[model samples]
Target: MVAFDRPHGMTPPQAQWELPFFNQHHHTLALGLADWAGAQRVDESDDRRACREWVHKLGEAGWLRYCVPAAHGGALDKLDSRALVILRETLAFHSPLADFAFAMQGLGSGSITLGGSDAQREQRLRAVANGAQIAAFALSEPEAGSDVAGMKTSARQADGGWVLDGSKTWISNGGLADFYVVFAKTTPDAGARGISAFVVPADAPGLDTSEHIDVMAPHPLATLKFTNCRVGADALVGTVDGGFKLAMQTLDIFRASVAAAALGMARRAFAEAVAHARQRKMFGQHLADFQLTQARLGEMSALIDAAAMLTYRAAWMRDESPTQGAGTPAYTAAAAAAKLTATENAQRVIDMAVQMFGGRGVRVGEVVEHLYRDIRSLRIYEGASEVQLLILGKAALKT
Candidate 1:
């Protein structure tokens, strides 16, 4: 693991928060978060340890409070999409791992927030808000990464309880999570309609999370295996055979925030590129003095701005539009567009930054090099770019 020194005085620009899409509270949150995120530094050589530390710090500072609702220790009355965007973007600008840790808290427990029983909410949401418990969402299986309905995991009734037998892979916070919101098929023949969700503790009797996966970036992933894992009836999250909708609902809420995260990374890369251009001497002058360098910087700036607008628009639509709830075609398309544009554009902008850095860009400890690895997964997860394109295409036909 290589640690790159954070450049001094490098912070994401706050001017965008002044747009009509954001309210004063959003601006206030951005300013406070920028200060807090800028001041914090953790040793990220060990990805798991760093993730745990970040969750703890974020919770203690009351930032994780935004992950849930005020009724359950959150700062807001509900999960505010704009606030989530601000928090993720700012944190990601400083550290992508921090953003990942923060995001999983909302995503892993999101179903509970949406449909958990009163008892379930009291038990889990509060603990999650406080960081006393870590959470993971187990949905993707080896064969079901993009096709949620193709999952083979099953849960059957047995002795007043449910017995789950299946596997989940590419699960973030897998080995480290205290509990998992595991989705499995309850009606083997019903496809997506057959799926159900359960809250399974990490220490559950037939559950295995010891298989850790190593990724190109600093994310803790694992493959989970369940061999007749049993949980009480109370463990079921939402209505029986409704896990698919609940899962999509949960993802919908965080989809725009994913775009915000990518925007943050792109801004960081752009900042690094500009700073480098101003300092690195070339031929007879600074790199910034060259018209070619200026042109590339202009292109990078335009890309970042375009991504930012899309990201903020998606978040704003979710937060402010009465009709923009999950499953609504319009909002869904907007979010898909944002995710697709931001992640793909971030990759391009980061690649441009790497090119500007020349040989130093590919060096192990270089910031752009780390960013190159960090930004690739964003395009694939939380709905791939191809999936987003299909969403937009289908939406266009509907219109």
Candidate 2:
């Protein structure tokens, strides 16, 4: 891991945390995290190794506590969306991989926090909180990316246990996780309703996680093949046929956090561009002195602010609004809007930053160049831009 440098004393803006959407604790959390994240450096030469190091550091620093509840060694009584947004945004600003490591800890085990039995909670939650074990959420298959119901993985009752058979692709922490909350269809013809969730240990027989996927970014992903992978009855999570709701609930909590991650990347790009402008000389003057440069910077700042507002609003709605939560049209629409705008706007902002850097922008190790690749996948994951558009369109029609 090479040392990360911040030229021109550039840091993510903290003024945004004072918005009404955040409380004193949120501000404190952001400030503390910014200081911590800015000082840490991991050799990212190997993505997997670097990810493990990040997780270990985050867990040791008590940052992973935010990923769970106080009962399970978390920092709060419940999962707080605003807090999650703050954490993801701050981490992503410094290193997108750090944000990824932090987010997956919560997301991979979210279902258990919401629906697991007392035994399951006791066994996994604390370990996850302390980094004794890693976790993964396995739901998407080769045929099912956003369409959850299209998954072909199936589970059946066998010899007083459950057997899972099928393949799960695009699984984050795939080969590295200690356990996976795997979703498979228990009722083959029931579409979404036929599904169920189970906790499958990574060492379980008949499970394959050797197929790693290389993406444009540094995220660790893999394809999992389970052929008659059996687990004890105690491994079942939630009620039968309840996996769909459980999965949706898990995603709901993290959806806005995704937008926050995008917001962080955008904020970083903006900071980089501004610092470059002030120092870069062109046409017998600094880049910042040009009217055209100022206008472009103005556009980038506005885009970041817009995305920030929507992302914060969505997180606030989830954490504070009585009418919020999974299946609530209002929160769903807000999250969809936030995710759509933050991701799309971040892409544009980063692209603009790259343009401003000219030939230097695409250089291998340049911050803007790295950010250019890091910001692309956010637009496609968790729910694509097109999906968010359809959701917004449907919400408008209903209104």
Candidate 3:
């Protein structure tokens, strides 16, 4: 494990896989994030602590600023897919939780970045960008993982404010978030259009978190339940009927970045596997000396490169899309494509790395072993591979 206590002073390392498409600024950012990530150690104990620490450090370094807008302390006017992809990919190579910490900052605060009022954006979004506060997005429910219309949470008009009731499940950064961007059914008969987004403060009346979720890769997660949680009308985010579009738009921007995170993991695995093949002796020769082993390593390298291309292509498409008349950027398609390919490829790449390590691969605490667990959740989160496939298929028919 990289020692977390080491002061954060190192620059990002030189990237071995820089592509011709990256500008000087991007290459510089990539190298800096990578070098900074390299010096840090993953904590084997208490992942939440590790995640929180990662958030503070990333925020302190001004990386979290990318999650918001320039007016709200971000580096860019809007979320930049290329920047996001590069950062996530680099951080995932070092620690999945670090990537998760960074991602949630964007995902949780995205609604505010995209649609919040100037006051809300200035106060809440700035806190998140500055690392002074943690934020959570509440959209998924027990029955609404991919179906936004199936949510049961509801909000209604009250005397002086809005009354919110019901629960949100699978909320990332749940218990730890200082505020939540919650989605609730404001008009059940309107189906998906009836949904609305609200900015719920952590200390709001009747807001509660039942338990911290212990997942395969531990981070700050929980189930949030609201019992008549009250917030003023100013808390309403965007248009009441426009919540679904807002949610999808937020996901569209972050989706490709998810793939970038997977790409980072694959790159790390490939690097480690190659190093092992060269060093580990087998029978009469080094593993890399064997033709079969060489073939496997070659295949892993090819897959990593291919996945990286697709990931970057998606990011580039989103960024370079024509702003004049571009309606709903093909980010949905690009993100889905990137997420599907990178995640599925990451699984294969990690499997190959683990195989190359032989017995040591499965041993507890091995780099490959930890990676094995870390890589599994990437395929399942944000949107599952199956979900991405559906999105891509729908997009293909449309195009």
**Cα lDDT of model 3 by residue, 1-399, tens digit:** 453322233222245336754677787777777666666665647876777887888899899998988888998887788899888887877677888899999999998888889988988887888788988989989888877799999999898678999999889888888899999999989999899999999899999986778986666789999998999999999988788888887887888898888888887788778778877887988988999988998898788778778888777777775741112537567667778999999999999999889889999767677789888988887788988889878878887
List runs of model 1 lying over 4 Å from the truth. 1-4
Q: Relative to the unseen true structure, what is the C-alpha lDDT of residue 235 in candidate 3, on a scale of 0 to 100?
A: 91
Every candidate's lDDT: 0.92, 0.91, 0.82
Per-model TM-score, in order, reads 0.98, 0.98, 0.94
Which lDDT tens digits does candidate 2 get at residues 103-167? Answer: 99999999999999999999999988888888899988999988999999999998899999999
When sorted by lDDT, best at the front, the candidate numbers are 1, 2, 3
| Candidate 3 lDDT score relative to the true structure | 0.82
Candidate number with the higher lDDT (1 or 2):
1
Off by over 4 Å in 3: 1-20, 41-44, 323-329
Q: Candidate 1 lDDT, tens digit per residue, 305-366?
A: 99889888888888888787556888999999999999999999999999999999999878
Give the poorly placed runs of model 2, Cα more than 4 Å off. Answer: 1-3
Q: Evaluate model 2: give its TM-score.
A: 0.98
